[model samples]
Target: MQEEFISVWVRDPRIQKEDFWHAYMDYEICLHTNSLAFNKKSSCVRRRYSEFVWLRQKLHDNALLLAHIPELPPKNPFFSLNNARQITARMEGLRFFLEEIVRCPVLLSDSCLHLFLQSQLSVKKIEACAEGRSRYTVAEAIQSSGCRVQRFCSEEHSQEEGETDSE
Candidate 1:
């Protein structure tokens, strides 16, 4: 039997016009379930940045390695909400975040992460309480879960290694 693959993407984020100038603009951080898994229905859940943050925090609190959590794009205070380039970059970052969550088996089993990816709740009420096992911190989780992580080498170092090793 083939393993189920979860495909996710972020689409059409609208900036809240009223919050555009409040030093922090609200973002429509959504995940669309382009579900490639068998017998699963495709879904689109509308969420916000805070909800995403909360999910990451929950994972961290549960002792899940943050390296397993995908990074969100950095905030640009100088850029206006309507700037096309900035918006596009943010969307891409959100997409990356979802992709990373789907890729990690440990993260896939997390309740909070599951809701972030598969739940239909609105942003305001998107909290998932701890259930079942005692939630350990990232290090403990790593030790107990036996989840393996690849050493991450940056592109620059990779290029340098290729130059030296391949010569």
Candidate 2:
């Protein structure tokens, strides 16, 4: 039997400007998997810190009785993109939060988690999509929005095995 696994990487912090006075950092969330639970083989979506907070709250409220939800990184009111240390800390925190989330099977089955990881939809749209009110399925929304879908390569498995053998 093939081993089923999923890996999520949260990186590439880029600041998006809504207007002259408003700007915020968003990270590239890339997921690679052979797990049957996900709709796609791989996906990449850009999300801001606030979106992560919203996901955490949604998961907590919806799955509170089913599983233990992990806490997200503390919100920094004075967040600055220019600060290297702060960016690194937040990136690590966000990565850890996602890693922990994917570990829970109960959480893995949630539509909110699937939409958040797989599509570029806003929080409201994700909620709509999850509720079956949207015209597009998650995969269709992902394609329509032109979100990045990465192709997994067999070479990566060989490289991982080579590194493990050398270690």
Candidate 3:
């Protein structure tokens, strides 16, 4: 899944090598031991690890990271102004760019369970909720969920997550 995501980015003419390198690193950050070419369990890669969705997240994160690069291009017309203003303006554009990326379902699917709970459910309940389980248990269960959408559910709960292409 990771390689496929990287391959797509690498093949795209719009993305330069450095951009793809950063994107690849961001993609690696998003994955676990369940998938990716280097994992021993790679052969058992789940169907739900949608390449499109995974790639979307990679690209989005890369965009956010790159958006922070200081606008220090030596000969830019805006060099006369303070560097802070130029950087701030660039950051604003980057924020908007990220917002557009966030609108895509694939990238948005990378939603963190922690963030979801913190915002929607209160912080106190989250800690109390984890009391009965081994730490690895929940993460393994999430990885086992057949698709990206299903991965969001907690362990000990076995609702069908999604219908994969093989199904």
Over 4 Å off, model 2: 142-145, 150-167
- TM-score for each prediction? 0.59, 0.86, 0.23
Best by TM-score: 2
Ranking by lDDT: 2, 1, 3
By TM-score rank, best first, the candidates go 2, 1, 3
Give the lDDT of residue 124 in candidate 1: 37
Report every candidate's CA lDDT: 0.51, 0.82, 0.29
RMSD of candidates 1 onward, in order: 12.5, 3.2, 17.8
lDDT of 1 by residue, 8-31 (tens): 556566665446455334443333
lDDT of 3 by residue, 1-167 (tens): 33222110011112113463332111111122222321222111111112323333445454565433222122244432235564444334333433344334443333332221112222233233333333433234334434332232332123223423232
In order of listing, the candidates' clash counts read: 4, 0, 1
lDDT of 2 by residue, 1-167 (tens): 97677777787899999999989999988877888888676777899999999999999888978988888889988878899899999988998889889989999888889889988899999999988889887667755655545333342444444443122
Candidate 1 has an lDDT of 0.51
